[model samples]
Target: MTFKIALIGCGGMGRRHAHGYIELRKYFDTVEMAAVCDVHHDVAGTVAAEIGEATGSTPDIYTDFDEMLGDADLDGIAIVTSTPMHHRFAIKAMEAGLHVITEKPMGLTLKACRQMREVAKKTGMVLAVAENYRRDPMNRLTRALIEAGAIGTPYFALDIGVGSSDGAVMHSTVWRAKKEQAGGAPLDAGVHNADMLIYLLGGVDSVFAEIAINESQRTLRPMNEVAPVLAEMYNHRREDGYDTGDIVEQTAVDTAFAVIRFKSGAIGQLIMTDTSHGQSLGVSTVSGSSGTMYRPRSRSGESPRIVRGDGTEIMGDALLDLVPGFELDDTLSTLWNGARHISSYDMDFRDIDSKILAYEYLDMVQAAESGRQPEVGPQEGMDALALAYALMESGVSKTPVTVEDVAEGRVSEFQDEVDAEMGI
Candidate 1:
């Protein structure tokens, strides 16, 4: 029995999700794109046409979400709207008796996440977060290696990414610059990092952070000046109110430095910034009693390297051999084309991205059909968001905040304004 799912918010991320559905059909016949909806009818029509061309079935299109919910015969809905709309759409769909798979960060604030989780619990619907980073095979391998003593009782990790956007709005989308809408990179892209850290290391205990907004004004970077892949992505973006000529006043914090303590007695230093001019830095590594394992950026399809105290390095197939019985699960193996012990993939960004997202769709559908929770369910989503929010809350209060407190809504100075604005 195939599940019917609808696509909501047919902008850039939504279009990518449409491709994910098309890719899901290549491996599994478990779900179909039944409808597409957006505030902009033209954007929704474009995505519907693309899905139709690729899948041989055209989905019904609607400009209004409520109309789609009432008219479309959908078992689930994929919420690909802006960050602020994630919880609103997910709660509405779940209340309408449909499962939901929404983009990362779960909700605009911890309170919003709590409300969505409550609704999911009450409705018995599968609410999955589209966190693709942990689905990468490389990350899976890294987890296995850590579990197998390759890192020998991990003690600390460093996840740092510093670069300059040169005053260009991220993804050329105006909402990302607004704190009320996107919560900047720390909450936008940082949630992925937060989720991956929890996936690789363990639960976070507390966080002490300093957040800053180094750039107050942002403009669209010329197509020629941006990276080819990003430029291609920007070209597909059709946000309702965005214009190339308009300048965005950034309200979200673009830089953050945090120190984290893990529940397993490990410590971590996380630094993320997009305003470091004249210098670029990137680091992702976990250190332990015996050795240090260097990790590649998630979904990059790169191999992880481990360097022992004796200066010996292990990588590629050798790394796989270190973990006895280390292999991808049946679903992930099928998605990666039966490569089990392989360390890296040779596919481009779009190929791997779509496959991962396709896995997310399949996971959500299977969970709904079986009356089980998706792998990244509400609790996991809430934890990741809590860790990200712990950073913001710590920054706002100028004190270390426990992840548990943040997740439980005990500490929420940073999110109070956002919650008030949304009336949550």
Candidate 2:
């Protein structure tokens, strides 16, 4: 009925969760954010203030999570900190008898993710990873068409990321630049697409990747500071407030190509290039026996128009069409936030509640308690990682890779490289 929440990382995402709660509070008669925790007291205090502003207010800000947990009557926690700390905090929150919804990719490794999942089960709490792309409006429509038998049993699929991996994607990010904080593109950027791939195409059975770092992707500063001129436009931002971000080095990649085989008799291929740019649909191409979907562009207007396949040619808001509760918004609920508010949403199908994402993750903790499907399982995270780890390995070898290969072997070489740099 009522949920008391705690925020573990008071970064942008932590604040975003607060914003979501604020929006939900205006309409739902259920939840409230109770407290927030961050390493930086200033950031934590500021976000806590923002949450109160949204929902009347009940949040207490704390610099340390343990202190916040100790002091508050918390019911659930949102772990939105850096990737490295996800496993630890998830465990802490579970042990404290609170539900948790975590940011995705689970943790730094499959082992850690598994451990966190186990604890939630033992503690009778919820553990759901925040893989939000699966819920994207565009992506939601795409999934609906596939499920509606629009795409009959997907056989072949392609994930393409063009122009998207540009500098814009890397803004306000340092962890991704350093392999220590980020697992490079395959893990950092591809994870979203990869997880979505799994969501649409079933499970991945194999992988092959060609990974390369771009030496040219480096940022440059004048060797001479006094009377020195800014060589690149990025210099002004760095000099003013950027984190010494002279792409001083291209630690990760300029481009990457990948192929994935899904266990559901489906094949998936992915292409990603930092230097390359363009636009495509659905992040890639999804081809099935029934039809094919061109993810980005809807469909050409014709008798048998080609949006993706040759059979259906229609352009409309598939997003508004497939959702269940979407149509009930204006009739059943109160619409206050904006046009998209549940009350005013004129969707046709049952709207997928993002609230489910939070609840399901908490369900992981609850399943840990009651034993059932918490939104999804811990294995889903592992499978996603295993597929990515395999792709990274294939990229290095310039050979076709299998997800089973990763399941069978250790990626110590790549991991060691990242770990050594991390001083782990």
| Candidate 2 lDDT (Cα, 0 to 1) | 0.59
Our model 1 lands, by Cα RMSD against the true structure, at 1.3
Assess candidate 2 and give its TM-score to the true structure.
Answer: 0.76
Instruction: For each candidate, give its TM-score against the true structure.
Output: 0.98, 0.76
Q: Residue by residue across 297-398, what tens digits does model 2's lDDT show?
A: 211111111154555554454434434434222312232223331211223121223332333333444454465655455666666666766666777767
Listed per candidate, the RMSD to the true structure in angstroms reads 1.3, 7.2
Candidate 2 minimal-lDDT segment of 10 residues: 297-306
Worst 10 residues of 1 by lDDT: 226-235
Instruction: Give candidate 1 regions above 4 Å deviation.
Output: 222-224
